[model samples]
Target: MKILFLGQLIGKQSIAFVKEHLASLKAEHQIDCTIAVADAVTGGYGLGKNHAFYLRKLGIDLLLGGEAMLSKRDLVEELAQIHFVLRPANFTGIGNFGYGMRHLHTPKNQQLNIINVMGMMGFHRVHASNPYQLVNKILDNPKHPSPFTLVAFSAIASAEKQTMAHMMAGKCSAIIGYGAKAITLDAQIIDETAYITDVGRISAPFSVAGFTPESEIERYTTQRPRKSEELISDEIELQAVVITLDDETGKATHLQPLRATYPLNVKAPANTSAESTTP
Candidate 1:
């Protein structure tokens, strides 16, 4: 039971590299549930309510969203009191604050059922609604009852080869895609049992898909276009994806795409032996 999966945070230096790597990734990779996707976590687009309560105080229980998380229309009633932050179920007129499927109870009981969809070509072009008919009506109305179900998509990167994301990966067990950008693109499973992945982009490992590749060359600049430049950064990186569930049928048997760069909360001056530290 691992399940890390973070992508697309894009701002505040990806929330200071997830608050400096949440206690060494749950004390050296014992992570049991840490998610992300706050549509450019503030100043890159949205994500408020005090940065979603400081990413649930740096533990990040949940938060999957997109279409720039609705670019701050006054924080949607403070992102609707953060009841685990979902928001994508096709987002057509956003009436309710947020949440498009929910039912997580892990710590061993493991009855997940997440959901959150998007893809109808999301991101800045916005206008969603029909992420495969709202994931078949959230697996036929799910607000409860679950053995395992996951699905977090936020389109872009050309909608990740839409066959409706391999047709919702045969009705969900894992499919956290979200437009991968400069790396982290591994897991796959479509039509034999659901498991798709894309965990890159928490922002800046030399910026491009997390922005500041000169804001995409100033949106394709013109007027004698032989000049180009970009690479602004605060030097961050935290791609994620570490699903190895099946703690008795949560069934995500393997998915490990993690990457942490940046001083990772410091403390690294201990290996000195080039002839006794080059005396």
Candidate 2:
């Protein structure tokens, strides 16, 4: 089975771009299933109910969420009800929210198990259980259902993510690291398991993590409260990774990173020169 795992979707525009190009991308890769991170799919902070439904309509089979999963309170009820959406499994009090693991039957009649877990280090604000322990408990289960398992390990530290990947190298089919919004160059197969440090984001290429550079710079320099981040409307691209699993063994056979530029109809805004003061 071939699975196309896209990077985080930043905002409404990013959603639109995906909707426009997703079918072509699937056809280009002969993809059988599609999955994407839903941390910032609404207005760049959290996934809203409407946006989640729209993403599903666009042919995304599953949605994964990270630390900012519940940033939008409106999505709480929807998450519980939806079977295609998932939050971090190790999150504290996770039973109240949605699930973090799901077993799905793909179009090719293959069972795929997916788990979303958040690291403990660096994410001080998030209260979550130890991801390592949780992952072990699930993978080591006596009656673990699916042989094809994918782990979405979201973390801020590269070392932590790498550690998780190595630990699960021979256990799962793939481990995709995210939450940093930048694609890492270390995409490889380890012990038949596909691993990528970071999957990148599906947003503008000319901005800072898909946001306007000016706004991010100002906020960092000022060290004060600033307005919401503004999404850059130019040079959008879809960055993701595709993993192919053996039909019988459920081990990853191939790992490929994909990047495609979106053709925007509107032209980029021209730079304006500052006027000189009267002499």
Candidate 3:
């Protein structure tokens, strides 16, 4: 099956690593996958003409652009298929936007699932205030038509992560944490969806830095000095949202993450079980 790995762009520095990863996957596993970088060729942290050109050369089937980057006639017509990753359901940065997919390989195929990721270093909200509204807007937009499975990613403190996890557990498709990074949750599926699998999860590199218990307490004391006078706890929250469009049920289900990390055995819950049963 073909898969698209959507990753963040740090700058030209990622070019080499990006190319190497894709090439190796194609050559070794015969996997048909594309890497969509959130930012690379443009100054606004979105895809630009040059960026698209470079990525295409590197074997990217589709290079995504940000929603806010006005229209470029040449790009609109040329990269139309893969252009404009949908704006996040709720989050919107000045130069940043979101992308949604109707189908993994084809557009307007609501049958397709999409995963949206936003990384937080400290405290800058990435997407929209009302993410659910933003999500609905995307689904209902007439100009850009498509059905989709939506998922979102963000980092958070472990404690807040647990609270969100417990509160949003079963309600989310799969809530996962990146350990002191961000929290991610699905825009849909509310209530009783909690699962024990989301806590203390880590990603591939195993290098994503996590905050120490002590450091967090110190951070709060420094930021909100008076809050220290009250009871304080240490925990980071990281989360991801998973949206699934079930063909059989003809309904889109949303699931929120309880923690930043997902269980090792299950990177993705919805697709994992199906992939196993496919063969």
Candidate 4:
């Protein structure tokens, strides 16, 4: 099965970009499922109920949440109703609202299991348990023998993300890390598991991680408390990875990084698909 994993999407323009390019992606390749990070999907905070349903209609099969999962209180009350959305399993306290793991079946009858976890290091507002311990318990004991198992680890620290990927290299089919908002060049397969440090963000490329550079600068330079980040919509692009899993084994046979620019700019190609670089 071919799974297209996209980076964190911020604001309305990013969602529009997804609606525009998702069709192109399907036309270019036979994508069985599309998964995207749900951090800042709403007004640069959390995934809202309306936006969540709209994204699902746009063809995103699964939406994974990070530390900002519960940023919207109204969404928190309705999270249990959204089956396709997942909150971090390790998230503790009253803020933690939805299920972190889900089992699904592809169109071709492939068993798929997805798990979401968050790190405890940098997220001060969120209280969470150890992701390492939670992931170990989930993978060590399987409720069902799924051919494909995917883990989405959201962390602020690079070291923590890398450690989780390496620790669960052979246990799962793939491990995708996010929350840094910058795509890492290290996309490889370790022990048949596909791993990438950060999938990047799908938003205006000119700004600072989807926010206006000037606003971010002002926040960093001045002592005045930082305001809500402002998202830019000048030129948007999709940064993601495509993982192809073996039918029988569920191990990743090919891992390819994909980047596509919207509005068909002259300088950059519409879609760039690379060959599998990992052995």
Tell me how far candidate 2 lies from the true structure as C-alpha RMSD in angstroms: 6.7
Q: Quick one: ranking by TM-score, best first?
A: 2, 4, 3, 1
Off by over 4 Å in 1: 1-5, 9-31, 35-107, 114-116, 122-129, 141-144, 147-151, 155-201, 205-215, 223-234, 237-279
TM-score per model over all chains: 0.32, 0.92, 0.41, 0.91
Q: Candidate 2 lDDT, tens digit per residue, 4-120?
A: 999988776677776678888899889988999888766567777777777898899999878888766667866778889999999996567888899888888888889999988
* Model 4 misplacement above 4 A: 228-231, 264-279
RMSD of 1: 17.6
- Regions more than 4 Å wrong, model 2: 142-144, 265-279
Pick the TM-score winner: 2
Q: Which ten residues in a row have the lowest lDDT in candidate 2?
A: 270-279
Query: Largest lDDT belongs to which candidate?
Result: 2
Q: Model 3, stretches more than 4 Å misplaced?
A: 1-6, 27-35, 40-46, 61-84, 91-102, 106-110, 115-127, 133-148, 154-279
lDDT of 2 at 56: 91
What are the clashing pairs of model 4?
Answer: none
Q: For candidate 1, lDDT tens digit of each residue in 35-112?
A: 787765665555666677777777888887766565555556656666787778778877777676777666775667
Write down the lDDT of every candidate, Cα atoms only: 0.64, 0.82, 0.35, 0.80
Better of 3 and 4 by TM-score: 4
Ranking according to lDDT, highest score first: 2, 4, 1, 3
**How does residue 91 of candidate 1 score in lDDT?**
81
